[model samples]
Target: MAFHRIFVLDLAGVGMGEAPDANRFQSVGADTIGHVAQQWPGDLSLPTLQRLGFGNIRITNPIPGIPPVEQPTGYFGRLHMAAQDNRRATGLREMWDYTGPIRTESVFTTLTAAGYSVTLAGPFLSYLATQTPAERFQVGTNQAAFQILYDRLNAPVSGLTYVVLPEFRFAGEQQDLEASAQALQMTDQHLAQVIHDLGANDLLILTATHAADQTFGPTPTREYLPLLVYSPSRQAGHALGIRRTLADVGATVLENYGVAPATTGHSLLNELTQ
Candidate 1:
């Protein structure tokens, strides 16, 4: 069950609920997915996510349409931001355990050093350009980003591919609940294709850097982001629980490649592989 390829999909602004320290940020009761589902005209169809344990996350806090299933195909969990604020840059850095003003090393660099090909796509490409030695592809929209990622997944290669979809973030910023819900549906459809195209050795991690709950305001909200891990080799899905930091993601990736993790978070590789 060793994974030769890992795909990290950052569905920006897709938060599940408020974080433990939401009050300090004046973001109590902020639930990106919940709000979008409630305000959305009808039950949001997310068959792909449901099969991946998206509904299981609602066992603690409910999302309108997604409900807990008897068995999920992947691991489900939520992650808390380790940074003081919910900034995009801070969240991304925390994923690799970077806390300094200037990041010297990251998951991308660590993977590259281990001889893994790292490819990054989406709007964050320029922001992360100087951090890692990766094959970067800048895309304009979420659709374009996912298309590029789909194309890469279909290629005959095994490595790490990271893509960030900003449409949700943009919709959240604009405070358009309808747009946000629509984008979620569209993303879910695209996710079905992505899952269908995944190879046996491919590992897919879906998460968010920060929550831009339109109901809260234009700024990012302090909220718990969704975490979904899927691989064809896994027999059944289980709850990963609340991760203290997003760095666990990087740790898991490094562990899969036999590279030691240089982060504060523990690796979930064992849990997923066991």
Candidate 2:
């Protein structure tokens, strides 16, 4: 499970499907991914994510300009949140399998506490990234943050590293889905930039802490989340079509280090080549 390096990009609130129990949260009609694309007033395209199996997640309406690919280049699937409350901290904890309420720890705390050398970027993880970088790129537009990350990718770093983006959340909150689509495009374009710079020995994980509710429609939106893994190591075409939880992600990260996650989760290491 030990990898030479692992990079996690948390695209905050880029939701895919509706949560099964969205009715109570007043978001039963939530489908941030779908809603954003549907209401987007302009052409939309995320060819990078589409190539990674994003389009395959939906059967009926694919995101605005994103269509399902004939064959995906990486592992693709959906993650269901274990808790009813959907917030950043809650989702981050769940990524590492913390289902208990009133918890104050996360995968970051656990991994670093265990003596893993780590470098972090973005606002959410600046607390840790600050341990190294002089200026943390935690606050800014998606374009701004990504510009920094694009450069950081070329710099040498060991152990676990992370990059967080709140722009999606910011854009998602915009009254205009067109604005949200623009943010999505900007992020994807940057993602493509950094992804190409990744080395063959590296593992890149793309996920969202949770989906959003930008559109408070009379109809509920989907609460499903997207998980895309980009690695030259993994063969293409296989899909990890199953229901997983955010905590499972934390567990998987731990698993990569040959450590067991406190919460229940199947290691995705083998699935990389599935």
* Top lDDT hit: 1
For residues 66-107, write the lDDT of model 2, one tens digit per residue. Answer: 888888886778777777676656666566444324554456
TM-score for all models, in order of appearance: 0.94, 0.84
| Candidate 2: stretches off by over 4 Å | 97-105, 124-137, 217-222, 260-262
- The best candidate by TM-score is 1
Model 1's TM-score against the true structure: 0.94
Provide the lDDT at 108 for model 2. 60
Candidate 1 per-residue lDDT over residues 72-152, each given as its tens digit = 999999999878877777788888653223545577877787778888887755577875678888776888999889888
Number of clashing pairs per prediction, in order = 0, 23
